[model samples]
Target: MAQLAQSITPVDAVVSRMRALDATLPERDGVAVFNRVYLAVTEEVDRHLDAGAFPDPEAAITLDVRFAERYLRVAEQGCPPACWRPLLQFRRHPGVRPLQFALAGINAHIGHDLALAVVDACRTLGCEPADLEDEFDRVGDLLISMEERIREDLMPGPDLLQIADPLTHLLGSWSLERARDATWSAARALWALRGLPDLAEEFCDRLDAAVGFAGRMLLTPLPD
Candidate 1:
């Protein structure tokens, strides 16, 4: 069994870990509870991959990438960077580093196009003019961050072939399936909540983009 490096402590585990410590809940406070659940789910996903419990490794990689990209879109565009900081910190896990490598490889192929698409989608949504600039800011930040991390941190030795191959393999596995599930969930989440009809359409469009990207991993050439 591989020793796990990072994990969200279970509620029971936390209480046990702080056996002698006293803790109290604040009035109507749900933040701590939500935080614990979020961490637990993240660790569960990591451990699921670590344990090889996913039905297919190849599909898992694609799904993971799609989900991560979708997440980055939300983080850098919709949510404040500070809201994303903690999740980004999860990249410290070794399992996560490879996922970033895989993401970089995918972005190299479609980064510019998808980014422009996202920006266009923002306009269709009639986002505040300030928000349009914010999205661009987020995009620039991501590009810079990716450049710095891939070189200075993630892979000390540049081995594109090694990085790309495993990720490709994993994308063909169950990851893609999970990726599909995520998009479908996105469609569900956007129902009437996004406010703008055009924006909601674009939201589903992006979700379909995710699904279509995953389907490409199917290997059989589809003729136009």
Candidate 2:
């Protein structure tokens, strides 16, 4: 269960707290911005999660992106963005910038996956499909903003060991296989949803399942 600590709701308290964290930063602005932004966003998210509003699928899906963006941004370069890493690793360079951009993209990917899970669960509801589509568009806009923001902070193009390999023999083993696997799993899950009316009840389960699959991947072997 990946601890799932990121926010799924975008609330005012989150923004306010993020701003406050940003305000308290000392001089020397290399990775401090990452630290401040991560704290502010995480605080904003944690503060909004209540029994009624947060645990619900709608709110959690939204805030997860906010949390992921914060984590990706603050993760300091050249490491898995764990809790304990030296501050000195966050060196500025033309290289290794794409890794940051790609990590930011991972946040968007997680949000997108969550949204799909929600929609799958809500397919039988009275809510029109258009509402889901509109919500997706809104999320897409946020993703765009994150992309632009990351681009501002990171250089474009591939670098670093963790960089996405688009032009390598690993594409088939790494990227395409994962896509195919996800597609097959999705088809099977959709098949399970057929002839079911209590879809709303199943959304969280499916969402969690999908998230768990990713969590397993993150736990796999990595270079030292």
Candidate 3:
């Protein structure tokens, strides 16, 4: 989409494609809100990659692209997992705040997509989760950093974020660190169940549903 050369790396391709999406989508659209947040993280990843931060660049690139592909596929199909469905359905709703959209997308991506992406990368690279741990941790750290920024940028002022504020309580309920830990555990579990496709599928489905439930809660419309 970016007219990238045939030789462009997978990571670059993913970044370029996201840039295109960011350019095309409406600013207030839910997908656009998430895209901006995600794009910032991806761009940071790209910077780190270029700076020789990742111990396994190839693995990092593969995992990053695979993870992003899950979300992109949903965008292309106009259909997404239960975890993502609520966000898409409410993308244009006026009651949903930008912060809600951003966090919901983050919930869906990190909670569900990251686990699957790890398995996908493992299969593609002929490696295991242990081998990708560094990449996973590095990416997770970037996400955590972005999460803080998202809150600071999208959250209401100090006075508005009072103890009784619903937004404050809502934001406090979800933790990116907790989600990252769970995703790592899920990836390990999924990898172990590779031989048992049925079990793995069930596990993934349950995860999707649970994540979707959280996302739906996060998207609860509030008074402006």
Model 3 per-residue lDDT tens digits across residues 89-140? 9999987888889999999999999999999999998998999999899999
Provide the overall lDDT of each model, using Cα atoms, as 2-decimal numbers.
0.36, 0.39, 0.89
Write one digit per residue (lDDT tens) for candidate 2, span 1-224. 01234444445445554465446654334344344434443443345443332334353444344434444444323333222122223323233233332332243234234334434434433343344444333433444445445434543245543444432222122332243245334434544555674773374356445544443332232222
The stretch of ten residues in a row with the least summed lDDT in candidate 1 is 25-34
Candidate 1: where is the Cα deviation over 4 Å? Answer: 1-131, 156-199, 211-224
Give the C-alpha miss distance for residue 129 in model 1, angstroms.
4.3
* Pairwise lDDT winner, candidates 2 and 3: 3
The digit string of per-residue lDDT tens for model 1 on 1-224 reads 12323343232243332221213322112222222322333344445545655443333322333333443354235441222333233323334333333332233223222333333444445443233333333333334444434334333255565645554464335332233234234433453345677886666556445533442332222121
TM-scores for every candidate against the unseen true structure? 0.26, 0.35, 0.93
- The prediction achieving the highest lDDT against the true structure is 3
- Report, for all candidates in order, the number of backbone clashes: 14, 8, 1
Return the clash pairs for model 3, or none: 83-212
Instruction: Tell me how far the alpha carbon of residue 79 in candidate 2 is from the true structure, in angstroms, after superposition.
Output: 26
lDDT of 1 at 82: 27
- Name the better of 1 and 3 by lDDT: 3
Q: What lDDT is reached at residue 148 by model 2?
A: 47
* Candidate 2 worst ten-residue window by lDDT: 167-176
Task: Please name the candidate that would achieve the greatest TM-score relative to the true structure.
Answer: 3
What's the distance in Å from true for residue 17, model 2?
4.1
